[model samples]
Every structure is written in structure tokens, then in C-alpha cells.
Target: MFLFKKNKDLLEQYTKYLELCAETLDIFRKAIAYSFENGLNEHFEVLAGKVHAMESDADDIRRQIERTMYEQSLLPESREDLLDIIERIDMVPNCADHLATLMTLQRTPINPALKSEIMELLDLAIESFKYTKEAAVDCFLKMEKVKGLKILIDNNESLGDKLEHKMIRTVFAENTGTGEKIIQKDMINQVGEICNLCEHVMDRIVICSIKRQL
Candidate 1:
């Protein structure tokens, strides 16, 4: 009974970690929108700070859960699988924090013409995250739901890739300096990477679910 309680507590902490990831992504979305609307002003800086803070909080929870799992005495394979999933999920917020910190520090100039495409990409990335996050929760709560969610996550990643390519081509075609074109393209890639990372996480989620079933 005590071991069961420990395992259950670990699961609860894991759920909280996932919730933090959701909050972090929402803050990231707001920061991106604010930056687009206001051009990375003081208000945007505040939003970025919130994103970083929430991500740090999530990291703390992840570490706590990891330690709890180690102490719970679950099957080695099962424990390793859960730990791997948590590590992969951690990448989503880490990417968000990295991108937010980069924008805050570098202050890259976003070209007016690319604003629409960039916004669209950002929206798609967030959508992908929502589905992926849901699927992740379901992996532990309801294993059967994962396959369906994987499809939605994959679609978003595909759309993001096409849009990213179009934006990159458009960036270079503009009559700007080569250096600026490269920088803007990198920014677009960073945003699109969110979707890619989401898809990557879902792949592991699906595999883990399957392994559990077997």
C-alpha cells in the first residue's frame, strides 16, 4: 500500500508538470503575439519573463517527480519509459524558453512582409502543442486515445513545415541584405521547430503506450 501511494503521488506530480507545460506554452503564445503587435517592447519583456519563470517551475516539478519515480520501486522497464517520456516533454518548454530568451536578448527585427506568415506559423505551433499535450496526458490516463491524437499532431507539423518553407523563400526574395535574410529565416525556423518537437514527443508517447499494452 505504501509503494502504491508513492507511485500514485508520482503520477500526480507528473500531471502537474504537464499542466505547467500548458501554462508555459500559453505564455509563449501571448509573448509572440505581443511581440508581433508591439515589437518586443517592455510589456513583451514582462511576458517573456513569465514564460521563463513558469518553465523553471516546471523543471523543478520534473526533477521532483523523477526522484520519486526512482524511489517507488516500479518495474525497471516501466520506470525507464516514464522517465524518458518526461524528459522528452521537457524539451517543449525548454524550446519555448530558449526562443523567448533569444528574442529578448537579440531583438531581431521582424520584417513587416513576413508578419502574417510568422503569425500563422506560431498559431499552428501552439495548436500542435495543445494536441500533443492532451495526448501526453491521455498516455497515462487513457492509453487508447493516443493514436488519434497523433494524427492531429502530425497534420500540424506538416502544415508548419510547408509554411516555414514558403516564409523562408519569401524572406530571401525580399530586397534585404543577405545577413538580415539569414537571421529572419532562422527565427522562422525556430518557431516552426515547436511543431516539429511536438510531433517528436507524440511519437514517443505513442510508442510508449504501445509498449505498455504489449
Candidate 2:
């Protein structure tokens, strides 16, 4: 009975860790949006600080989940699988962290047209994250749902790449200073990377579904 309870606690902590992924993504989403809108000012700094805090919180939850899993004495396969998934889930927030930190350094003001395009890209990336959370849930309770989500997440990934390319060209085409253009290009890359990482996580999830069925 005690072992069972311990295992149950680990499961609960895993769920909490999953929840933190969504939270971290949301914080990053807002921080990125604010940076685009406000141009990495003090307000943007405050938002970035929130992203930092959430990433730290997620880290704590991840460690707890790992330790609890180790102590609970689950089957080797099950423990390893959880660890793999959790590690991938952990990567999703890192994209956010990178974006929040990297963009603040650009500090170059965005023109209206480019800002609109970048906002669209950010929106699509956020949408991809929503799909990731959905895929994570379906992976846990309803593996059947994962296959369909894979298609959607893949499509989102493709869209994100196209937007990234378009924005990079847009950044270069703008009549900005050399340094500013370079910074904007890097910012665009970071924004697109968030979606790529989300797809990366979902791809692993789809495989986990297949493994579950096999």
C-alpha cells in the first residue's frame, strides 16, 4: 500500500510538471508579444522576469518528478519512458527562455508592417504549443488522439518554418542599419524555433503513443 501511494504521488507530480510546461509557454508567449509591442523596455523586462521565474519553477517541478519516480520503484520500462517524456517536455520551456532573453538584447524598435508579421508568427507558435499540450494529454489518457494531433502539429511546424523564412527575408529587405537587421534576423529565428521545439516534443509524443500500442 505504501509503495502504491508513493507511485501515485509521483504520477501526480508528473502531471504538475506537465502543467508547468503550459504555464511556461504562456509566460513566454506574453513576454515575446510584449517585446514586439513595446520594444524590450522596462515593461518587457518585467515580463521576461516572469518567464525566468516560471522556468525556474518548472525546473524545480522537473527535479521533484525525477526524484519521486526514482524512489517509487516503478517498472524499468515505465520509469524510463516517463523520464524521456519529461525531458522532452522540459525542452519546450527552454525555447521560451531563449526568446525572452535573446529578444531583450535586440532593443531595436519594430516597424509597423514587420511587427504585424512577427505577431502573426508568434500567434502561430502559440497555437502549436496549445496543440502540444493537447498531444501530451492524449498521450497520457487517450493515445488514439495523438495520431491526429501529429498531423496538426506537423502542419503547424511547416507553417512556422515558412513564416520564419518570410520574416527573415523581410528583416533583410527593410532599410534598417546592418546591426539592426542582423539582430532582427536572429530574433525571427528564435521566434520560429519555439514552434520547432513544440513540434519536436509532439513528435516524441507520437512515438510514445506507438510504443504504448505495440
Would you estimate the TM-scores of all the predictions? 0.92, 0.87
User: Model 1, stretches more than 4 Å misplaced?
Assistant: 1-6
Instruction: Compute the lDDT for candidate 2.
Output: 0.74
**Can you list the residue pairs that collide in candidate 2?**
none
Q: Residue 167, candidate 2: how far off, in angstroms?
A: 0.8
Q: 101-146 in candidate 1: lDDT tens per residue?
A: 8888998746667788888888887888788878776776657689
Report lDDT (CA) for all predictions. 0.84, 0.74
Native-to-model Cα distance after best TM-score fit, residue 209 in candidate 1, in Å: 1.2
What digit string (tens of lDDT, one per residue) describes model 2 on residues 41-60?
Answer: 89888888888788889889
